[model samples]
Target chain A: MAASAGPEIERLISLLAKLPGLGPRSARRAALTLLKKREQLLNPLAVAIAEARDRVRTCSVCGSLDTSDPCAICSDNTRDQSLICVVEEVGSIWAMERASAFRGRYHVLGGLLSALDGIGPERLRVEDLLRRAGNGEVREVILALPATVDGQTTAHYLAERLGPSGVSVTMLARGVPVGGDLDWLDDGTIAQALRARRPA
Target chain B: MAASAGPEIERLISLLAKLPGLGPRSARRAALTLLKKREQLLNPLAVAIAEARDRVRTCSVCGSLDTSDPCAICSDNTRDQSLICVVEEVGSIWAMERASAFRGRYHVLGGLLSALDGIGPERLRVEDLLRRAGNGEVREVILALPATVDGQTTAHYLAERLGPSGVSVTMLARGVPVGGDLDWLDDGTIAQALRARRPA
Candidate 1:
């Protein structure tokens, strides 16, 4: 529907519609909500977005996003520099950080090597990863990519490349999740759990 | 989890988290997506929001949001000037516009009169509506408010106030929605639909 609220509000609605989960209807609702709480919400949100646009930068070493070049994780000396967890995107880095389980450094590959899409190691940061691994500091290069075909292919490729460099290559464990019910578990997950069963 | 992406990105995420359907996790993902496509998405979005903030204003006569003083709908001379649809907010105006059914003007009440929340007629545009009705131009005032208790109370109050002025006060019909499933229909909707049933 053509917006009766004028072009500026319409522009805001269209822009908000580009967000991950927001559709045109919800974007219109969000625009109205922001307008209703202009002083409290809209102004602050606008400022924050503008500041993020001006300041946010990708880490040159790893591909994580931050205001700084190397990012806070890469610059911090306390983190385990010997362990480099490889991921496909910056969002995975944030997810890993949220878990608070891994205390190692990260390497964002930008994307997986998809043969169907013609993406290869040249398109990704595989050369940078090999160089980092060859440098005597890193001992283990963890492949924290997805379980999909492209992810597996990329993992295998990386393992072959990093093997000669003396860095151990490992993938995330595959099994049923901790709180998952066996009755609801898919066949693939059940089989993996059976194969990876540990002693009590 | 604490954000390692720095304060600016964190600020954007927190602000985005306050949107209607987004939570902390989705907001973080949205932020990363925005940052990843900064030139294409984030910059334009920030500009749009800033423009909306600077230009959008509440129409003095109807309480609807617009860049102009009277809003496009309010100033349009082609619409039915004798019919005024009273709604609770600007979002409802957009919904009504999407239907492409109404050809009249609108009066936004800002919110319904909620006694439990201590809201009364004074806090709304009830006085402006009364003034507009008494101007001897409006022949009908349609209450397009929600079906909640507060919505009904506000409609009743408006009807009582406008009864002596010789202006017709009406409400939107309550019935089952056009494409609603009978099995999923609530008791209230079923009763309303049955009461309003028409002979084929």
Candidate 2:
């Protein structure tokens, strides 16, 4: 709206400012860089953004963002239908995918249980997970939850509920991660899960 | 377009993918995380992006991106008219500003002279720079070009041209930065330019 600012610059700066570690000044610099490199960075980024925006979706069965409703893993006939890898978020699912070790389908729990946040099992898709596990085809359930206390609590709760179903339960190996989100983990982690995986 | 992906997740993925280091898969994961924490990171990021985009602009005189045209520095009358700092890009200008050392105006050359790409002084605003230098107000020209060969070439050429214009020619101190972009340098190097600056 200012006489000095153009519409394109304004749009770019605003979007850039919202990113992590960038403030208003940094955002302005970033926007200028994009404009200057529009032929290389901006146009391609715009195209990539549009394509991803149009194509990405969530798997209804597991809540993972995928191009397919059931996703490639769920639809793959060779993948183990009798196993489901339960994770706290879609990022965790992607991390598992990056390792290329998991042959089972994924079930994204959306988030971990947190008492401070009053996030009950009912608030999450815990019921959906239970209903899916009850379908009788699943032979194993892997809790790829975080190593935090909340993550442990959520994993325990799920294991307790699914135990009576006679299905085997497992979890990702510890010490492969050090922080909050599994998405930030290196590919080595997912591979370790395949090598040293044990029953929960 | 896929039955599995939803609008929110898609939007977030597209947005995240446009970042410097993020690819499609990483973008998707980031989007999903933001969606799960929409109230915390996603919505605020979106709003900040929009606001910055709306407010940021290029300084008409110096080409620095800002909320004002002449920008805060260019409009400030207290800055020395007898000294003009020449930089390769607006990032360099910002680096100088962050140090709060320079009390003169800036002239951004946009980029260095590159013969490999057939970029010459004509492509850059070299003529405008000469005209501005000859405007009778500026008494000294300080070159703050990158240490790259092309950057040094441009600085040399500018020095040669501005020599006859009766303005003193000097350059920022060297050896402080080793193969790093001037943009990435700390404010200390920029401030040191004022303290130990030498004849070009």
Candidate 3:
């Protein structure tokens, strides 16, 4: 007898549909693709999911998902303890790691200070970051915040608050990304913005 | 203390890199995307994977994976028992189902007979299909095989063997898909070459 389409496949489709840029059609295609390649893809994927589920946990000190509290970076003696890189989200921290540009310890602010969304410093990990910094090991703070208005506001808020504490504050340079287009630049006497880039 | 990176994350990155269309960068991005959306996407995806791992099984009769053997189409009594549509793979079966054009039984050949790959009739589900057809309920067989040389060879072999068994054989109508063009034509041309379709 033909069996009814059951809850298991239905649940898988529903979860897959929730991914960014995926809808029901793409979800169905992906599910079927995974099903067809069960030996090479599906089995390993299942095992990976199980292992990650068992091992992943939130770092109590930094709120980054790690297997332990204080995470590896926070506990690493070789990393610069005095220099903290503050980011808006865990994803941004991962992006920084991929760039391999910064070796400093990280502090995830969870989100920006957004008045429209009613998000303020109290809603973030800013207080914890300040407390940790006040322990006197932190000497310099690098703000790797997004360039949005709320991000800039949050950066300013931290700079004003931490400046009086005698910690040097810096921001990541803002300009063109490593590979950006000049043709997309608008208007102008074009004479001014070109002169601003320095050999930092 | 900061712990160094471990083999688990490395294993995940390597495995994810092998997925279709995902390079190392996109794989890393996707992995982090899943992690950051854990409550919304990752956890539920994990749950679904676990559930599917426990429930999915191959149809003993057709070699298709489903929650039950003989699948939904095989078991449905209202579908035409006298007509069996032979297809190359489960993907084709799913595509046909999406069209909602055929209301009949399906016999998945698993693959076309390919000399280059040294695949033969014995390597396909041809034996199982023959056994099922010999039971005498089927009166018509539709060769919904691809129009590739191997696919045509497989279709011809089936027609030759099945002709003496007293059954009428048919194939899909010839035409571009409703929105498709001749520029996209390939294996499908064999079907399309059979006729110019009248506007329905």
Question: DockQ numbers for every candidate?
Answer: 0.75, 0.17, 0.30
Q: Which sections of candidate 1 miss by over 4 Å?
A: none
Best by DockQ: 1
Q: Which one is best on lDDT? A: 1
* CA shift of A112, model 2, Å: 4.4
> Chain A in model 3: its TM-score?
0.87
TM-score: which candidate is best? Answer: 1
Q: Let me know the TM-score candidate 1 reaches against the reference structure.
A: 0.95
Relative to the true structure, how large is the alpha-carbon lDDT of every model? 0.90, 0.72, 0.74
Question: What DockQ score does model 2 reach against the true complex?
Answer: 0.17
lDDT of 2 by residue, B130-160 (tens): 8889989889999999877899899999999
Deviation of model 1 at A73, angstroms? 1.4
Model 2, span A1-200: residue lDDT tens: 12123444555556556555556676666666665565565555555444444565667888876666787767789989888999888777656766777788889887888999999898778888888888989988999898778999999999999888888899876545455366777666666655877787
Q: Per-residue CA lDDT of candidate 3, range A2-71, in tens?
A: 1123457767766766655456666666676677777887788878866766786667777766666777
Task: Summarize candidate 1's per-residue lDDT along B78-131 as a digit string, tens digits.
Answer: 999999999999999988987888999999998999989999899999889999
Q: Please state the Cα-based DockQ of model 3 relative to the true two-chain complex.
A: 0.30
Off by over 4 Å in 3: A1-6, A115-118, A179-195, B1-6, B21-23, B37-40, B113-122, B145-161, B179-195
